[model samples]
Target chain A: MYNILLFAKRELRVFVDTPVGYVVLAVFPATMAALFFLAGSFFAESEATLRNFFTWMPIAMALLVPALTMRMWSEEIREGTEELLLTWPIRLRELVLGKFLGALSLLFLTLLATAMIPMTVAYLGDVDGGVVLAGYCGTFLLGAVCASLGLLLSSLTRNQIVAWLSSAAILIALNLLGLAATARSIPPSLAHALETLDLGLHFYSMSRGVIDAADLLFFLGLTLFFLVCNGLVLERRLRR
Target chain B: MMSPDSSVLAVKVQGLKKSYGSIAALQGVDFEAPVGAVTAFLGPNGAGKTTAIRILTGSLLPDAGSVHLFGADALRSGQDLKKRVGYLPENNPLWPEMTVEETLAFAWSAQGRVGHKMSAVERVVVSVGLEPVFRRRIQECSKGFRQRVGLAQALIHDPELVILDEPTNGLDPLQVIQIRELVRELGRQKTVLLTTHVLPEVEALADRVVLLHEGKKVVEGTLAEVTSVKAGQQQFKVTVNGSEEDLKSMLATAGVTRLESGFPSSSAQASAVVLADGGQEIFEAAVKHDLVLLELAPRSGTLESLFYGLTQAEGLHV
Candidate 1:
């Protein structure tokens, strides 16, 4: 626990020191807000809620979260700092968890920046408070899942661009999970599994103020799955 | 394997084997470093010096073998033994965006000793003479200062065993001298294992030498013991105006060993030769004879020749 925070603190500092971190943190919400107000026609919609922002975040995070997490391990490995970190007395899990939490913390702040859109909706007219809070919860869960995916892919390569592209490809496939669920060619059983496995399905279910245990379990389990995979890859490098 | 209570041998590895695909990085390499001694790990470029250092420092795993550090199982102990180990890897990995103070503090946290942070960092800073660039970012500092930072971080925890790989690779002569001084000081109190191609560095700092070739140790012993054959028999080259017989007769009465008069060195013809207990006595003999001495150089009796001879025999010459 202590080692995790030790690494997490360093990861946070990396964001502050580098322009990439600042650009990702600010641009993520700015682009989301722009898509919400400009492209989606915020005032023209006949609803007093931030449904547009919540709807756009899944697709936005598919690319944006990868951008944020691409540098997590790729830069460390490329620059040889990975050797220093690995040889430190801390366990490998603590280092991975610390960096993951550090990246998620930035995502938390970016999500918080978009709260003004819902706050504006509430000011204009009646808005569902439970739904707004649940949407924020759902966003955090999605970011956690995507961030872990980015981290796992980042460990597989020394190049940040490769990490970014590979993670973006997988994330794009995940974002399109709903389409696979309704496709006819994948067979009824596989299509059913696809719907059950869909990230968007769980996130959307939570966004509607449901907060089901199954949805939370799916996100938590998937995040843990990817974190374990990342840990395995790092350990394998040391061994083989 | 060393018993847990034994401190005579600081590190021991046996039958270590590692391979990447079909290329073996280490094969049946055995090594040991005695406690409280400065040991030099010498090898050619493709040798397993760095590979061995990586395993000892807990950064790399060997395919088959065991490593015991200060009598602790390095393979299975996880981070416990590593707490007593400090490693400065090749290239001196550091955070360029971080200030020297920040890097030191992070190392303190890494050792799981968060209390007395300021004193610990300040102690290392002073030890490395890093007071001038305490707040400077790593990228802005020169390579020598960056090396000082690397050394400082490695020593911040005061580990029992310190391992440095190519610590003075890209430094000026003055910087090398400074690092050599610091390393010599470190050897007085701590057990140090360093790898270098610089033969004089071994002569100046190492108490013991371990020379590896083609992933195997070809020579390991005391500095004098290891270089005994190459530089053991004392012989000096002499260049004087006197004839060979005249020079030989003048030094015949001196307490000298067998003297040979020939061109033993490649770049010069033989003026004279003195097989003596020490090279300085040649000057005294020349002065006593009123002979005009031109050049008096010792034969290649140093680590450089020993390194070349050993590696060349193994076909691993650098």
Candidate 2:
């Protein structure tokens, strides 16, 4: 537990010191607001809620979370510091969990940066605070999922560009699976299973202010799955 | 097989084997470093020196072997055993963005030690002479100072065993001497295992030598033991003002097998390696032929010659 916090603290410091962290923080909220107000047709809808922001948040996170997590393991491998880190008296799980938490904390801050979006909606109309809170909750959970998947792909390679591209590609595919167009192309049975597996679909369920246990379980389970796979990849490297 | 007294051995490995695809990195290699000694792991590139060090440091897993450190099963002992061993891997990898102070503090905290953090960092900082750059970020430091930071992190927790792989690999001459001096100082209190291909490094810092060749340990002993010549044979580098035939005849009479001989130069000075005692007979023959013996020095075996001989005999392109 102590080692995990130590690694997490160091990782957070790295993120804060590097330009990538600021880039993600700036771009995520700006893009979220642009997509919500411009492409989302906020005036046309005349909605009293951040429904459009929630709608675009998953897709935006799919792109930006990879950028946040790409260098988590890839840079260590590239710099050859992985040897120094692993040889320390820390467990593999602690390292992975700590890095995951660090990236997630940054994602949380990115989410918090968009607080004005919710405030603007409330000032303009009677925005339901419960639904707004649920939407943020869902987005945070979805970002956690993306963070873990990005971290896993990062561990598979030493090149940050490769890690970013591969993770972005997979996360985008998972998001697309939740779309109606993708569902129409597949058979009903296959579409049902893919929809259940779709990460965006789980977030959508939570964004509706339901907070269903099934959706929460899906996000937590998938995150754990990716993290475990990351651990296995590191273990394989040790043996190899 | 276990040693008779395992407690005295800081590190012990038996039948350690590791292969990447079809290429074997380590093959049934066994060696030990006694407590409070500097053991030099000498091998050419691709000779599995780094691979063996990685295994000992718990950075890699062996296919089939046991690693015992300070009488404990290191392979399974986990953090408790790891805390006792400090490793500075090859190339001295470190976070360039971190200040020297943060690097030491991180390393100390990573060991799970509570309290005394400031004192621990102070001790290692003083020991490795890192005070000047203690607040400087690693990226701004020179290679020598970066190497000192690497050493400082390894020693932050006051580990019982310090394993340094190529500690002075890319340093300038002065830096090499300074690092060697620090390593020698560390040897006064801790068990030090250093790996290098440089012969003088072994002579300068190591108390014992372990030579690995082609994934196998070819020799292991004290410095003198590993470099000792066999009985009844002696090597001499003799430069004499004599003809080739005179040198050859003199060597034949002296009962010396010529390992190598050089051609006579402008001054008719030729040198030859003769397997005899001090070339006393060759000296007599030189006198008989009126050949001015410019030099006759007994050539002692060196780690370089032994390393090359062993590697070359195995058809390796050393």
- Point to the candidate with the largest TM-score: 2
Measured against the true two-chain complex, the DockQ scores of the candidates, in the order shown, are 0.58, 0.83
What's the TM-score of each model vs. the native? 0.87, 0.89
lDDT score for residue B101 of model 1: 98
The true-versus-predicted C-alpha distance at residue B215 of model 2, in Å, is 1.0
Off by over 4 Å in 2: A180-185, B1-7, B230-299, B314-318
lDDT for each residue of candidate 1 in B1-318, tens digit (9 for 90 to 100): 111222588999899888878888888988788888888999888788888988888778999999999888889996878889899999999988999999999999998886999999999999999999999999999999999999999999999899999999999999999999999889888989999888888888888888988888887888877765433445566776676655665565454543344444333222644445576666787788777677887764457656765677323210
Q: List model 2 lDDT by residue over A16-83, tens digit each.
A: 88886788778777777888777888879887878777888777888888988999999899999999
Model 2: DockQ score:
0.83
